[model samples]
Target: MDIGFASSYLRSLFLTSLFSFVAPLLLMGSTIAGLSIISYVPWLGRLSQPGFELVWAFLRTFGNGNALEGSLVIGSTCGLVGALFDTYIFYRQNTFRR
Candidate 1:
């Protein structure tokens, strides 16, 4: 491949890889933050305890049975893992490229 072509291709790949790794965590963190804020409401609080509610329990277990910081920690860890997964997928895609 030509030098310029290779450089551009690498730049694109780098950006894609970076975005894939960061976007999910940012989205997840924002969602978790928004939900945490919304859960302060009385009625919606009740609706949040079936599926994603375990986050609270997990957070509580981490701290003094409280679900704020713990949730963030858990969510961040999950996000990091997710980012790693994205990186792995990028690697695989590049490896299998035609």
Candidate 2:
């Protein structure tokens, strides 16, 4: 009865939070790995590493937006989690009965 859909969607939200702590790492890794070979690259460098300076222009280029990056991920995932958790609570309750 679409209960499975609710369960799966909730599962996805759970996974989001469970893995969201790595958002900053993902950004730095993407820069290193040429900005993810799968996703869209910026207009500057299409298939190469972006040379944007993050914090210390003289030394570091990444890890500048670590907290900001994590915050963005947590905010987005929290919103999703709240919505899906509310919607799926009924299914979860019913599933427990069966």
Candidate 3:
């Protein structure tokens, strides 16, 4: 086994994990901010109330329980899967070339 190859792969895997984890949190934060802004829009607020309630409930359940841990686990799993897929594709391409 090549140490350099292994290290490079691990580095990519870590970056993938970090990106997946951060992207969702950023999206969630932006969503919350947008919703908060919308909540003050009078007519729009009334229209969005039920949807907001549902979202709030969902967040309360997941966000309060184990959101951070869950996100980490999910992100790592995704990264691993992506890395595996990439490795498979690379091998396939090399095999074809050889």
Best by lDDT: 3
**Which pairs, if any, clash in model 2?**
none
Tens digits of lDDT, candidate 3, 3-96: 9867977686667656765676666567666777898998889866776666556655654565555445554665567667767765786689
Q: lDDT values of the candidates? A: 0.63, 0.52, 0.66
lDDT of 3: 0.66
lDDT of 2 by residue, 39-75 (tens): 3545645434334333123223222446445445555
TM-score of 3: 0.62
Summed over model 2, clashes come to 0
Segments in model 3 whose C-alpha atoms lie over 4 Å from true places: 63-98
Q: Can you give the TM-score per candidate against the true fold? A: 0.50, 0.26, 0.62
Clashes (backbone N, CA, C under 3 Å), per candidate, total 0, 0, 0
Ranking, TM-score, top scorer first: 3, 1, 2
Residue 86 error for model 3, in Å? 5.9
Runs in model 2 lying further than 4 Å from the true structure: 1-6, 18-20, 29-98
Candidate numbers sorted by lDDT from highest down: 3, 1, 2
> Which pairs, if any, clash in model 3?
none
